[model samples]
Target: MRNMKVFFFFLLFFSLCVEFSRGQKEITEVNVGVVTDVGTSYSDVAMLCINMSLADFYSSRPQFQTRLVVNIGDSRNDVLGAAAAALELIKIKKVKAILGPWTSMQAHFLIEIGQKSQVPIVSYSATSPFLTSLRSPYFFRATYEDSSQVNAIKAIIKLFGWREVVPVYIDNTFGEGIMPRLTDALQEINVRIPYRSVIALNATDHVISMELLKMMTNPTRVFIVHMYSTLASRFFIKAKEIGLMKPGYV
Candidate 1:
């Protein structure tokens, strides 16, 4: 009976040690949050790329002690939805880093949440120059700011000798923030902006058609369109229906 008791005690000790070692090994897991509109084509592609890159990275560095665990949250393409997603990632998932909330409007709130949580928010698609003024250390942009593209747009206008242009953009932070720089760039080259047309991100097809028709009534044939690809696709579809893709349009 004495020998059997000792044997059971030793078995228990061995089991505890094994469990402790397994727990220690699992402590190397790092949780990362991906917040984006999964409904969009851009984010669908981005998620695939991220998964492939992570797989390739882990395969290439098999000896690495740390492992990354990805947790995805769909922002649903809205400000409140983005904030809720970020909050869930930070509070519930305890993610160390956040990658995206694709638009500037979404990024604005996520940056604040990241700052409060001391988590880094990395954005690859939010390109508003307005975001730069916030100067939050927790916010990191992997993509070019909208201001950076203004010069390229200006060059195009100059090349075509388009004296006047109309700016057609979505009514959101991403669209609003880019205009000041774009307007300044166009003014530098003596190009005039006759009017500005704003379309809501969630605008219906009928609304988009109306806006296109309003734009068509004007004499300015050249238009500078800046918005998310999803909305931009709708805008172009309506523009095509209105014959804006013809030779007269610059």
Candidate 2:
């Protein structure tokens, strides 16, 4: 009976020791959240869904050892959703950083929350010129800015010797932000904006077809500013269908 008791004691001690060792070796946990803007049905999930892709690209780097905690914000293309998601991540989840709310419209919500909470926000796809205007210290972007892209497009237009051009952009920050700059550049280049059209980011179908059809009449090179991927892809596909494919098509 005494021998059996000793064996039980030893077993308990061994289990405790194993548990303590595991506690010591536990990996550090890091929580990262993502909030996507609501545009198309897919917009709210696009950037958040792409986290694995981003992780794969950075897996070799040593800074990514901790597991990322991603949270989705369905900022239905509005500030409220972004703000709510950011608050949840910052206050509830205690995330170290955040990645998205992809559109500038959605980004504004995240940015506001991030500023108050002091959480770093890394935007992978937002290209709003207003973001640059804010010059917020915490705002960091991975995609090319609209100002630069607009300048390049202007140069391309000039280089191609295009006299007149048309503009087709989404109504949100991505589209609205580029319009003024593009217009200013056109004025500087001595070119005219013969036509202009705007579409909602959430528009699934070809809302700009009317403008496109009109532009096709004059055949002025079209400059399309699309921030949402679904819209961009669809626009390109439609442009091709309408026999409008060229080097500077959009």
Candidate 3:
């Protein structure tokens, strides 16, 4: 996915470069924007990879007379922040294209700005199916939508013969994005969903433990975990700490 992101971004800037190169004598610099949650570990890694990819892309293709200059923006992991970042980049930095807004909710707002500004919005990680409904030619998703995985999930549930299943997901747009498709898939397999567990993005260990404890009272044992990796890891740890990972529980 990261490689695809780099490829898409390069494709945008490269196209611009091609146009800029024609009727130019000296090397031209093209400005592009990368907006994401700046302080997080994954964001740091993504930024590093983007920098490395840009360097490698140019090093081997030294004949090209166009260079892409990156402008980074911190979205602060908020929807409005992402929109603001894109607007600032478009107005102030005059970036030709935008790389990210991270979450689907953030992308939701950023897409509108892109529509008004006529700048392309490309995302590598925002996988909401809702984005496609907008029918905006400016928006591009590097990754597949959450609904794309529902068929596999349905097949697995059918194979396991799990009569009852519960979806454990985040409360935000990322979590809700896949629910409709997954729900339909589970219904097709005759899997009854008694409850939907919603975890907050900033949920604490104690909160996760309480949620697990609440689930223990229910009859359902099968849980479809759909959430961010970091929060899911913490949730599983808390689950194991409370004996939720033992036999008879899925």
Candidate 4:
């Protein structure tokens, strides 16, 4: 993950405290907080990556005396839970920085908390334009911004010579984050966005079918899908089952 590189670079900044670390012992413990939805596939994989990256970082730089002590907190996939976790990490754990909380929504509240506590909030996957718009110096994005994908989408649409396209996205902050930029990019290329397919995160099989049926009624077959998180996989499965993933559509 890109975050691993960012974390590795972050170690250089931690080197500023090397003297403080050396004063204490040969190996200094640098506490870093990781907040995320604990049981999710992404979270589990990311945790493993973080551990592996740290191991590699230490093995490569044995001469360095500072070591990151990762302290994890479960956000339980809720906004309030994320805030609580961040607060606990800052107030009790005394973590110098925090890693994640998964989504843009969770990061929204945590960013303010990080600002108040002077802790750096780094996210690798929260891609909402709204997050960057906040202009919080304490907040760092390890991944591309949501609007950055508009250029690629525009290029694809132009190459296909599609006049009209629909945006099929999850109904959430992360999914909606790219719409304005995507619409503007399409408009610049003289493309019409006939409709937006706002699929609910918890949409069932019937709900997905109803949405697909609605799209079928419309003439626009080309689509730019930006569904968020795990919903994208389910949405594609339903679209394929409904025969919408054929050669006629995108």
Please list the Cα RMSD from the true structure of every candidate, rounded to 1 decimal place. 12.5, 13.4, 1.7, 1.8
lDDT score of model 3? Answer: 0.87
Judging by TM-score against the true structure, name the best candidate: 3
lDDT of 2 by residue, 63-171 (tens): 4333444566555556676778788878888876777765787787677777877877877667787887776777777666777777788888899788877777777
The local lDDT score (0 to 100) that residue 134 gets in candidate 1 is 95
Global lDDT of each model? 0.82, 0.66, 0.87, 0.85
lDDT of 3 by residue, 59-94 (tens): 888777888889998898788788888889999999
The TM-scores, one per candidate, come to 0.85, 0.67, 0.93, 0.93
Q: Write the number of the candidate with greater TM-score, choosing between 2 and 3.
A: 3
- How accurate locally is residue 199 in candidate 2, as Cα lDDT from 0 to 100? 74
Tens-digit lDDT track of model 1 for 100-169: 8788888999999989899888887788999999999999877778899888899988998999999989
Backbone clash pairs in model 2 (N, Cα, C under 3 Å; residues 3+ apart or in different chains), count = 3
Candidate 4 lDDT score relative to the true structure: 0.85
Q: Best-fitting candidate, measured by lDDT?
A: 3
Query: Model 4: how large is the Cα RMSD against the reference?
Result: 1.8
Misplaced by over 4 Å in model 1 are: 1-27
Across 56-141, the per-residue lDDT of candidate 4 in tens digits comes to: 87788887778888899899989899999999999999999999878999999999999989999988878899898888999988
Query: Which stretch of 10 consecutive residues in model 1 shows the poorest summed lDDT?
Result: 1-10
